[model samples]
Target chain A: MKTDEKTRAPVARIPDADVPGTVERMRKGERRAIASVITELERLSAAAPALLRSLQPHLGHALVVGFTGPPGAGKSTLVNAIIAQLRQQGRTVGVIAVDPSSPVSGGAILGDRIRMTAALDDDGVFVRSLASRGYLGGLSPAAVRIIDALDGAGYDVVLLETVGTGQNEIDVAEVADIRVVIAAPGLGDDIQAMKSGLLEIADVIVVNKADRPGAEQTLQQLVGALSIRATMSDKVPVLKTSAINGEGVPKLIETLDQLGGKVRAEDAVSRRRRRARYLIARAASDIVANRIKAGSKGGLDTLADSVLSGTMSPHAAATRLLED
Target chain B: MKTDEKTRAPVARIPDADVPGTVERMRKGERRAIASVITELERLSAAAPALLRSLQPHLGHALVVGFTGPPGAGKSTLVNAIIAQLRQQGRTVGVIAVDPSSPVSGGAILGDRIRMTAALDDDGVFVRSLASRGYLGGLSPAAVRIIDALDGAGYDVVLLETVGTGQNEIDVAEVADIRVVIAAPGLGDDIQAMKSGLLEIADVIVVNKADRPGAEQTLQQLVGALSIRATMSDKVPVLKTSAINGEGVPKLIETLDQLGGKVRAEDAVSRRRRRARYLIARAASDIVANRIKAGSKGGLDTLADSVLSGTMSPHAAATRLLED
Candidate 1:
């Protein structure tokens, strides 16, 4: 049961009995079994294959919304407000809060865990905190798989929280149905308008901490930026919310409702399919890379020497290794 | 020259010019075309494929070192110090600083560029700041390609300065021969030392800004943590340095020298191959996923409606989408 002892130890695979039956039952709408299996998977990469198999069915059903912004932008608070409102409408929610863990200790600071104190006790709400674990896009490949697992587990909504401000956090755009980019006042006007590659991915932008001094200014600045980029069809909606005082929480909920409909109805399914295929491509690349790396450990040094001596170029040498 | 302007633009293959006809000449032990082609590519990525192809005979040779840590951890300063030490010993160094651009602005803060001031004016020192655009790893997929470009260009030592701290940043361990994870004192001893996936990948641990009050204590804490996970082959060396004052820089450089050799001689080839393979897989996945998504825009909504209407289970829907 406790499989993670040594690095070289062969990782355990999900039992065949559990795997096939779980997949079948999950397809037939078994929730508790799927959720239990998913929890066990949190400890290790084991159970991932079975989980992935089970997740195959829910690929496009649940709406995935990603929330990201600078720290102290009231993201967690806003998420809580959104969760509460969604639950009121009888929606089952799956929440993943990605907290930064100790690089050396692997223990989570659990910042969001502590903050989402309200969601912990709600049975309708399943809040799981995942360590960023140095994942670039603020999430991991495994995280993408897990999102699928949650979607399969019958949750009506899945919310992914990412480390804010850092640029690598944009990987969220690849996986989510709706992206809520949060920002606050005093962060500069240049920060308001999202640009070509980064902020352009946001479906909805929320200026949190609306009670702050420059909230209106931030809002006005954002509107100005959007005017230049907003095509008649691609207009990004900006909303103001005080997650602390609960201002605009209802409006935020209403906005989410609209976005959800937009994503699932006209042209949204095609968009998500493209994202999913990309995820698959990314996974394939990771697998091949891991294999080639595992095979070439012995020859790297001599290659380096030959390279440093000007006897070979790094590109040529790299190509050789790939060929080998 | 400028590709991917339209979201659906085809992925263009780099011409053989990306790599100079270095392999052909290198087989004859000649250098005629290699230098000229690589020199042209130093200005940008468009010229990479041609240079890469031409240098195919000489790659997988350079000792690629990756430097990463939290912001303000003195990574740039340490990088400068490392380069100076290497150059004094007559090593030609190529430095790549991975700076994720503001998605909205398509621009980088260029902070790391300022720190490598010492190398800026040196012809032997090739310093580049890369935006972690599109790729999750701190370095771009194009980054490895660029490193190949540099390797063919004749730089002996390639150093990667990853500007990300999350999991995507952890992708550096896949590409570098030696990974130097830098940390500052007083951030949180347990937090820094306990990072789950990030700290485990370090070949060398650096505690920069060691002049602070708790610097010594921080070093002690780090050493203690490393001891628990330490292996006979991997006793990650921890160094204390003040990049600003240059104290302990020499020791750090010496450690890098020792470790770089170890990685290059024994495992260098496989490591680079693995990195290349991984990039290929990711690229492939990106292409596939993008196309699938473009084709399946409203599939999720239709599925969601089916599930909500009790026509199908969530699991069933997901499986169908993935399979399709």
Candidate 2:
């Protein structure tokens, strides 16, 4: 009878067969249960579906805030400082640091996580570093699932932090309710880099390390650049922070709180719907990839022939398939 | 007649209308023509398709070699040294440095490219820095198209250099005929990092910075790790190179040449077909994104609803979408 576990559907598996019991324990702030659920979901064990289903109703409780910036933007320092501010407010926090590095720096990423989160001894603060192993490398589906897991476990806030400003890193912004794009002075072309990609996604922009020499110029450039763009009618607060000194953090927290109630106040159903949309989009991409792998997709062979023969561009053929 | 330019399709646009002439010049080793054609294609200007079509018959001339590793692995120094050795053989080389950094350091990527390729003043050497502005942090469709441009322009070899080993960065492996994953001593956990991800895609692995202490140990670990991996049927040659001292590079080049002819020997048709498959797969991802944006893709809403309601896991819902 125990061997029957192998033949059963993934939703009916053992670790997750105790889904309800785990969920109950996790909600009561049992740290082990919370960690177990996240680990099983991240590894995509067979029990993930049942665990996810059980955790669904508890989703959307935590306000997911994302922090991102260029490599030298002092994001980890800012994140640690923000964690301190959050802890001071007596809010339980779960920090998920998602860095999809080249496969060569696994130890370096762990080293980074520990260094950033080392001092917090409070049980209310749980830190998990997610190495983005997704196809594109920013926030993976596992991170998405883990966010829900943290939310279900009753964390008051979930901070999603991603390293770098690559295309995939920008994607981390999509999942957060409040997206904060960080910048620092004297790191040349980062502001230009922001102008091209990160500026648009930012709900709140921070010029960290404001004590640096060119901080004022950097702030003005950002403000000027934001003014020229008419996309977001609401003013995106551009603030300066000296993360080392803890200066400007309290103001930052105040601004975040002001933005929070309005952003996170959407009804539970709508909030869940927004997440559903992002999830479905990710799923659709995976479906296309699998179909491509199978290689017998309807007209893909013919379309590839057309591309090689110069009758159609690769993109135009893909569009034709979608239309069909 | 000038007014008509506004309404015409991209294929028939001005810069691209001279596609045939441009291709003729580029094929004849005209550096300006090569640069111009590549510029137009990279920007995806109105004339890209026509330009691409014109270059079709001329593709697959150069052997594309990809160099990737973790940050501080000396990828730039190694690539530059290889370029010098390739130049010693009187072969023309085109080096494309693709770094999809977190958006903050536009200036830094440029600086690295200059430092890597600065000493080479030969007309036979063409070096371009491509900041990966792709959706993910690694290789993009633009990189694929530009590779064809370089190949058609008749560079004897194309060296593709991507910074770091993000998920997207490993993607540089896909387009290259020969994939070289580099490692170095003194990089903590980099060897461990390779075992998990970089090892699988590596055609020829190198323990770069071989002059450093622990070089032998890193090399042993790489060999041991490769032995354990069963996916790669052919023995992947592991070499050691000191980019600073120029030691072991000649053997490295010899190994690459031995692997190159066999890998690149496939007829132009199959070569084009391989490239087409990659392009089509990327297009499929884009198509899915557009469908998600349009929000009317058949039954996506229903799938999202099911996902939101916890009746189906996000991935299961995606699988169902593909089945439908």
Candidate 3:
């Protein structure tokens, strides 16, 4: 137990690992080895290629399912049920719940702690909650890499529970094979699920807390909204589940199972390919930003000050920095 | 009128001001001459040294205020009021709204439309909606440049309205001078505001829809949450407002006025400098990533395919790319 705790702690280290050394360790077929490797990677203050090389093989195997919606929508409850059903089928599972981070201290309580409390002791269930390190989408550049870790660790199905669907949760749209948006009644916006871009991204919509009033109304509204915006290319399914009583969970799993079968049969890999390219581009961009910020000897700062003061224009400042 | 429409159309004839020759024209300070020049700058997929140079004088004169919270918090309404008040005070305003892009088309509908709806028809109110070009925060690299355009255009206040307080919305926290999170009654999860990092980033909290039930409770909770989590740096103020009725709006504006005064007094220039550094570094990274992606033929795609096929590891693939 002590050794396991020690091993697990290093997975969250930061500012370490350029893409290279990590790749080298991963190439050695050392699964648990990457744990300590991420520790060293954290020390580097940037992603190394060697590490990325090591991570590539592990990422492609698992079916990554992203679960997101507004808070109190019982997202974890639904996820818990889905995991249990998959476990019954003898499938290994990996769970990544993106927890909120305290901006001041950079500490997070990992909300899934209470939700997945029962699964803690199960060796078949490996759940990790990533704290949002002030990155957009509740995901830092580290998330894709962490997903790689879970995939390499041999989890057959990876369940990614996002922070929510309000604004930034859309980051999951970049990485998931399937995205399930959970919602309930009285979310204030009668058009809660429909308004904004939320209407467009959901592959599967689950109206949890079905026992409550307005569940049917919520479903009808979503169906109505989907009819208006949805392309015939895909017919989104809306399901209702009472996460508290575990009602309708089996059907939700069945819906997911059917979708999974279809995605694998069709050109889902191509879609994933496009998304992967975007992710790589984003990661590379993050690295460049960090490098530029670190390398500038107060040059960027001074220019920023000048621009803000109206003494220099933003474009002039940007041009100078880029050209330099 | 028809000719003007033809010119303003984003897809129509490229704005001559943004053309290659625009830079040469700009060095001469030909005011209306540069309008076409600025528009032409948007078409080029390369670095625009001329546009950057032209914007050198006005990058940071504006006080950037980000208005965010849950949907229906009357953010637009509040902004409209502020615009009116600022114009009364004889200050020009620039608005950037980060709206979610269409999932299918990735286009934004509210870009020019929302500003018009707000009755901000004055020559001084420059309003633009920035849709995501597949970026995480629904903001493009062009956004900062647009801010520059507005700044150089002589706007004293730049107001940025993000999609809302989800993960992506939080990214705005890093880019603005003042972040005002708008909340209202019946949100239910006070803890969510904290969990989402809204409470931490807010320099001011406006509980819009003050007439709604639970408004007082929500405000109280927000106050309590801030007091507990805040460092010794500053205390965030929570104000009540009805953007519809115009109640508390004057107070809100006064608060903004006071905050701006304080920022100007205490190292205002230095603060802009820090933000400028952050922006440049971020942009520099985007450039590097774009080059690497474009430079590598289908190299990245092939490796991603292998990883997906379970043939090679992610780390291995990333390693190969790094070596290249």
Backbone clash count, each prediction separately: 79, 6, 63
Please state the error at residue A135 of candidate 1 in Å: 3.8
The numbered model that scores best in TM-score is 2
lDDT of 2 by residue, A1-324 (tens): 122266343333346458799889999999888888888677656666678778877777788899876555678788889888888999888888775543435546456555558464577878877776532433566677778788889888899877543334555777788989888887553234334345656889999999999998888877866766666535799999999999889999898888889977787556656666676676677577566756764477788766654456667877776666
lDDT of 2 by residue, B100-215 (tens): 54343553645655665756457778887777653243366567778878888888889998764343465677778898988888755323433435665688999999999999
Candidate 3: tens digits of C-alpha lDDT, residues B1-324: 123343332342434355445544443445443454345343322223445555565455777888876555667777777887788888878787766543323323453456364454466666666654332333454555566666566668889886533434655666677888887777443234333466656788998889889888877766655666647225677899988787888898889878988766655446545565665565555565566557664788887665443344444555466556
Model 1, B131-212: lDDT tens digits are 5652233345556666776675667889987653333356566677788888777644223423333455678888998988
True contacts kept of each: 0.10, 0.26, 0.27
TM-score of chain B of each: 0.72, 0.84, 0.70
Supply the TM-score of chain A against the true chain A for every candidate structure. Answer: 0.72, 0.83, 0.68
* Predicted structure with the largest lDDT when compared to the true one: 2
Higher-ranked by DockQ: 1 or 3: 3
List, residue by residue over A234-276, the lDDT tens digit for candidate 1: 5688889998888998898788879899878845345544444
| lDDT (C-alpha) at residue B53 in model 2 | 80
The number of the candidate with the highest DockQ is 2
Taking every candidate in turn, the Cα RMSD to the unseen true structure, in Å, is 9.3, 5.4, 9.2
